[model samples]
Target: MIKQIPVLDCCTLSGYKEDELLVDHLADYLHKHSSLAFPHRHNFYHMVLFTSGGGAHAIDFTRFEVRPMHMYFMVPGQVHTWEFEGEVNGYVINFSREFFQSLLLRPDFLNGFSFLNGIAQDGAFQVPAHMEEEMTAFFERIYEQVNRVKPLQKDLVSVMLLYVFMRMEQQLSPAEKHKFPVYNYTLLRNFQKLIEQHFTNLRLPKDYADLLYITPNHLNALCKEYLGMQAGEVIRNRILLEAKRLLVSQDMTISEISDELSFNDNSYFTKFFKKLVGMTPEEFRKNKA
Candidate 1:
């Protein structure tokens, strides 16, 4: 019997290979069926630079059209799918949250960065021929140092990677910077972090409220004020989004999905799903498939 590969998080990517930094060029050969391969969110973050071809990429409910010279970032817990046509070339850099935290102390740096904002306002940055040569040189340097046996050299290469990210941030448009609000951003950020961690096991508004050290009402208000949706709505949307992803991509039965989401019972799960989705789980899956 063929064994199945276990699902891995971003942190676990380092352990899979002997050269930790080689995880930087990590690219997966995804076939058509590859979309069904891994449905869970990753713990580590990703910076994907697409060099060629076109496809549909989805994160949460947001989707993007993939083409050459397109760069995208996927933070932990954002469920994503990439469907590619023909050959694609690019580098996928995987680094932990700690890697970024150590470099960007200011919360506004990444919080303000959004692919949507960039595409909407500044237009997707097309790497000029000269710039591509420079980027290739930087990547080659990192690759060589990562493969080096010396520990000091490896650390230096890591620093270079940090420099690359900082440069990329600088290239972002001013509109993108203004999009992210510094104050109260931490609350939203922490709430998202918590949701990614416990969405499967804990779905209640009070659970998140308690974790954030605020009342359920306050949490709801904050989510509403900033996101234009209540806390409960965010929680339910995430759960339902995951449900749809699994239903379309996995062979798991409805009962299995219910158990995975920690629903009280299969019937309750069905009704809850129907109420929000306007159809039974089976019907939804059938329509999608």
Candidate 2:
């Protein structure tokens, strides 16, 4: 019998339950007929390092062939499913909202890579043969720290993981790294993170500025400079994207999507959707369907 797997929740890692970090030797865990799928509602991000084998991985409606030495990253709320045909060896790092918030606050660390945002769409990092030794060394250090006996070893391992990510990010092209501004990049990153976290509850630019301890004008300037759009436009785009996703991907009614997004009423939400999307929500969903 094919075992029915429950949907994995976001905000917490649910599928692989072992608390201790260890290398998952794929031959031990994967079954020929079994597959893994994640929940599409809650928001928790994941970074996956695939060291061997190949498979098909799906994110939302997008699918990719997972080959050896490729790094795959998935954002929260993106529905993901995977099937393996052969050996699968990898490390998956799951981090919570607080973890990402703290990282975004460090400007020097995150500002140089605007290409990171594009990772969801085209974000696979191919491990070069020359770089493989360095990558292996870094992963070994991470695994050692993760499995260490010290009480604070996990925290230390988290820091090492960030370092590893930085090293990997450095391998990207200069054009990719320069996608966003370098100055106040930290603030803009934080704002984007906040918007991702609170898009349903807060849509105003001032709300984000207040949380980041900056003026709305400053936030607007950063968005215009780096994102090539106004700050409000980014927020609205996120909201509308979610609205359309829920509309087409799920059975949620139009009123429910509207209410979930916190509009005054369905009519107002419809107008908002129409203004930006150039089509009503119903029309967009219908066209997509």
Candidate 3:
């Protein structure tokens, strides 16, 4: 039997049966939810604006250092865990996919923000020194808004969060923004989403390109331009990430993990893991331990 890592949802964190959003101070949330400081996944969008802290956290196997005025975002299904040095305090918001539907006209308003688009590297950033005052106030407002009892409170909170996103988006350089046009970002993000779903069954770039209705060359070009890797490499990276994720389960042996990831055989899987990772699966697991 496999002992799966925990997947936390809004209800589990807020203790509200029908809650779709959670807004709280980081210190308070951490105090009540310290048990979740292990490897886990969140079922909703999660973001944190750190005002003060030291240490590190991992999102989708990538470790990021925790520091003052830094923020990070996580989309649903990404695995993350927190490790703080001491007395971390900031703001955290977790909202469902539908949290903005009733308040916004565009169904895809949230997708326009690069920081919230589900990539681990793109989502974490340090708040600029000039914007720190305004940025921190936005989070404080969100913390206060959630405590108020009023009509359309969720809608109001949604708008405030949108403002926060807008200001943060301004901090990104024009070169970064111009590199990924809307059409290209849509295709690239969709391709990644498909890989998340079909990586085990479909390992080729052409397979994903066909589904996205673009030529294989075009797919690879977009990936190279934006992600600095070929489309196939992106797919393989997702597969490798899942392999690492599965290895987190001690009950699952290397053979079982290989089978779970739909590799043809244990030996091939071992070779694949070692080639890209520079270590055997067992070695990677033991090292992480």
Candidate 4:
């Protein structure tokens, strides 16, 4: 167990590849980058469509079985590790955050797909049987263009990728698409951003509410409406998540981890972890180990 999780970036993983992008058959990709079998996080957005596999992989702390035609989308800074039983093959597309930004008018175009969101469970999905042939063909086309770059190769790739995302979106039920109003959804995302940035130092939802220029009650209402949790709960959940991520590595002691998260003390942090997780930090680490 290393003291810190490895955060991988595009260039380091891309190697001889250019253009801030990596496209390859998963089996071939893994053969060359076998070190990735260990737990790690990536700086670039990552996705994989497993055509055949067994066993399971954990994204963050939640485990999902490797399945045929299943797609996993990962955002930057999320820890992922895989345990495989036998052969596992698929198409893995890893690209820098800017891979699509410069090509599209909307800077946050990728976020429109819920599967691209940082949540562990939301990032994993199984494509329908009918769509597998078309999706695999799309992946193949992107792979083919890698070696035979045309004048506007990347532009073509971006269009194909966006179409793939749109097809995925089309599968969602109407109810899932319109759960939160546009304004409230934007506000909720803003609130989440603030929490992500300040969760270590700011413990209260009002602190985030102030940053968002919204009242605490209003912020709470948006969170409750969109996330099914109170604003405070959302903030606490972020802090707890960071704590769990930190605990995964062995470098930090309980006291050090508590201090790192701005906790009042080791005992308080232990109680908080137990109250929600049903196990002490040490116990959780041991069990996972």
Candidate 5:
């Protein structure tokens, strides 16, 4: 049996209050809605700042320790669950992709952010102590604007959100800033978009290369140069992530998961998973349990 995970819509989850965006105090939001304790997927983007807390947050297949002065980012389709000790206080912001694209006039605008672009090794990080107050203030302003009945509401939210991202960009060191050149960034974005579309059926580098109008070698070289990994690793990692999600979050049998992922057979999927994860699917599922 596959345990069904809830796919939450931003507007509905936020009480259908402010259209496609929701900004609120984390503790207050949790207080009102207790069901968030369960693992869930959001159809929109999610970012939360932790002013105080100690716990664990699992994003995809990795569990990250929670700490103060930290931020976690989650793009659509990623599975996440969290447990915090004592009083966890901070701000939570959620917005849909359509909402962002409408305001920015660019469908792939989020590719520029390391957090959303899969360029960040882990989706959570600790903010420098000196920047905590400033980050909090930005979230506060966004919360206020979100709740206010004002003209040009969407534009106002977009400006405030862009300010936050801009401030984050400014904090990046010169080396980090130059990590991805403009052309490479475009390739990365296209590659990621293609993966989301075809990861289920197409797992080969040549297949993706054909889609991107590049030769397989060129695609592999670009991925290695920018992401520090071959294109195949990127594809395998994504499939592995989804496999883990199904194994742990859902109650699917190993054979069922293998079939669902379109593997040649159960044995091939098991071998492939163990090679990368250092454990068979059954072992991984047992460990999670």
Candidate 6:
């Protein structure tokens, strides 16, 4: 049997079975819950602000060096693990998708944040030193408001979270903001979401296009125009990303990974991997090891 990676939920982290929203200081949270350092995928979104600390955080397949004034954003289903050298101080916000979609009444809310999508760029950002106080206040308020749990606490949480997102968006490079498509981008967003959910079973661009109610030609055209790649390439890249993740994060052999990823055979899987990565899966694993 194949080994299964751990998938954590908000309840698991906070140990508060009823609450979907949890906020706590980084150091205290880590000390209180020792199991969080292990590699796991969460079912809820996470926002971490590091006021003081130095470490590296692995999200999905990529490793990001964490430092002061840096905030890391994670969406549900991305595998994450962290290592901190010394005393770490910060704040963590964990919220469910329902918190935003149902409570906040924003269905496509997460799509608005480029960093959260994990396609345009990595999910970590360095905040300017000058804006330290302003950003800290946002988290502080969130911590206080979360603990209060008044009648309108959810509403308060929703508004404050939106403010935090807006503040971070202002810090993004103008080019980064304008480079990707803005208007009418839902089609692409929906296509990407579908790819994430059904990549193992659905490998064809037309497969996703059909699900999105658009022609494969139009999908390819939009991908080429906005993302500078064919729709098929986007699908392949998503698959490739997951392949790399499983290869590196787990002890599974190439054959096992091929089977898990639903490839026809190990030979075809190796060829497909080497074509895009320029290295066979075995070679890549050996190099990483």
Any runs in candidate 1 off by more than 4 Å, and if so which? 1-19, 23-45, 60-62, 75-80, 95-137, 140-152, 168-181, 215-217, 248-251, 287-289
- Candidate 3 has an lDDT of 0.84
Rate residue 89 of model 3 by lDDT.
96
The CA lDDT at 162 in model 5 is 83
Which candidate do you rate higher for TM-score, 2 or 3? 3
In model 5, residue pairs whose N, Cα or C atoms come closer than 3 Å (at least 3 residues apart or on different chains), thus clashing, are none
Error of 5 at 102 (Å): 4.6
Which model is ahead, 2 or 5, in terms of TM-score? Answer: 5
Cα RMSDs, all models? 6.3, 6.7, 2.5, 2.9, 2.9, 3.5
Consecutive 10-residue window with the lowest summed lDDT within model 5? 169-178
Please, what is the whole-model Cα lDDT of each candidate in the order they appear?
A: 0.64, 0.64, 0.84, 0.82, 0.80, 0.80
For 1-289, candidate 4 gives per-residue lDDT tens digits of 3266678888877743464888889999889888763578888998899988788988898899998998888999898888877899999988899888768888877866767767787788789888999999989988887745654477778788778888887775222566666677778767766777788899888888888888999998877776789988888878888888888777789988998899899999999999889999999988766
For candidate 1, lDDT tens digit of each residue in 139-232? Answer: 6577556655455354465578766666665666342454655545667767876886788888899999999998999888878876789998
What does candidate 2's lDDT look like per residue over 160-200, in tens digits? 86677677666664334655444476677678778878999
- Lowest lDDT sum, 10 consecutive residues, model 4, at 172-181
- List ranges where model 6 is wrong by over 4 Å: 1-3, 15-17, 118-122, 128-130, 148-152, 170-176, 179-187, 204-230, 248-256, 278-289
Candidate 3 lDDT, tens digit per residue, 1-289?
A: 6665677878778743358888889999988987774688888999999999899998988989999998999988788877789889999999888888888889878877877766789888888899999888878888877865544377788889888888878777333667668688789878877887799999999999999999999999998987789998998888998898888767789989988899989999999999999999999989876
Q: Is candidate 3 or candidate 4 better by lDDT?
A: 3
Q: Candidate 4, which segments miss by more than 4 Å at Cα?
A: 1-3, 104-109, 148-152, 172-175
Ranking by TM-score: 3, 4, 5, 6, 1, 2
Candidate 1 lDDT (Cα, whole model)? Answer: 0.64
- What TM-score number comes out for model 5? 0.86
Q: Which residue pairs collide, candidate 1?
A: none
lDDT (Cα, tens digit) per residue for candidate 5, span 57-112 = 87885778778778888888787888788888899888887777766777777767
